[model samples]
Target: MITFWMQMRRTIRLLWSLFKDAETRGIAGVTTVLLLSGTLFYAHVEHFTYLDALYFSFTTLTTIGYGDIYPVTAVGKIFTMAYSVIGLGVMGSFLAVVVKKISQFDRRR
Candidate 1:
C-alpha cells in the first residue's frame, strides 16, 4: 500500500501537469463547473443537503447511478437528464486526461 505522503506527492505533480495542459482548453475546468452547477441546482430544487447534492452530481456525471439517492420532483428529473447528458462527455474527457497523466507519471518512475 502506498503511504499517504507518496500519494500526496504524486497527486501534486499530476495536478500540476494537468494545470499546464489546461491552458489551451480546460476540459477539467468545464467538468468542475458542470459538477458545481448540478450540485447547486439539486441542492436548491430538490431540497437536498449540500453533501448529498455534491454526491449526486459526482455519481451522475460519472454515470455510476447507485440509486441510493436521486431526484424526486419532475423539474429535478428533467434537470438531471439534461445535466447527465452534458456532464457525461465532460467527465469522460476529464477521466481520459487524468489517466493519461497517471500513465506518464508511472513511466517517469
Candidate 2:
C-alpha cells in the first residue's frame, strides 16, 4: 500500500510531468475547468445531482445530446452555446494528443 507521503510525492511527480507536457496540460486544464463550471451551473440551475450534471456536461460537450435532459432557461441555453464553442476546441486538442500518443506507441511496436 502506498503511504500518504509516497502518494504525495507520486502526485507531485506526475503533476510536474504534466506541467512539462504543456500542450496536453493546457488542453486538459481548460477542459476540466469548463466541464466543472458547466456541471455546477447545470446542477444549480436545473436542480440536477452532481453525477447527472457531470454526465450531462460530458454528453453535451461531446455533442451527444441524448435528449434525457435539456436546458429550459435562457441562461442555460446561452451557457450551452458558449460551452459548445469553447469546449470543442479543448476536446479537439485532447483528441489530437490522444492520437499523437497512440501513434508514438504504434511506432515502438
Candidate with top TM-score is 1
Q: Candidate 2 — what's its lDDT?
A: 0.82
> Can you list the residue pairs that collide in candidate 2?
none
Q: On residues 24-101, what C-alpha lDDT tens digit does candidate 2 reach at each position?
A: 777888889989998999999988899989998999889897989888899889988898888888898888885675
**Location of the lowest summed lDDT over 10 successive residues in candidate 1:** 20-29
User: For candidate 2, what is the TM-score?
Assistant: 0.73
| RMSD values, in order shown | 3.1, 6.3
Show where candidate 1 strays beyond 4 Å: 1-12, 23-25, 102-109
Please give the lDDT score for candidate 1. 0.86
lDDT of each: 0.86, 0.82
What TM-score should be assigned to candidate 1?
0.75
**Per-model TM values vs. the true structure:** 0.75, 0.73
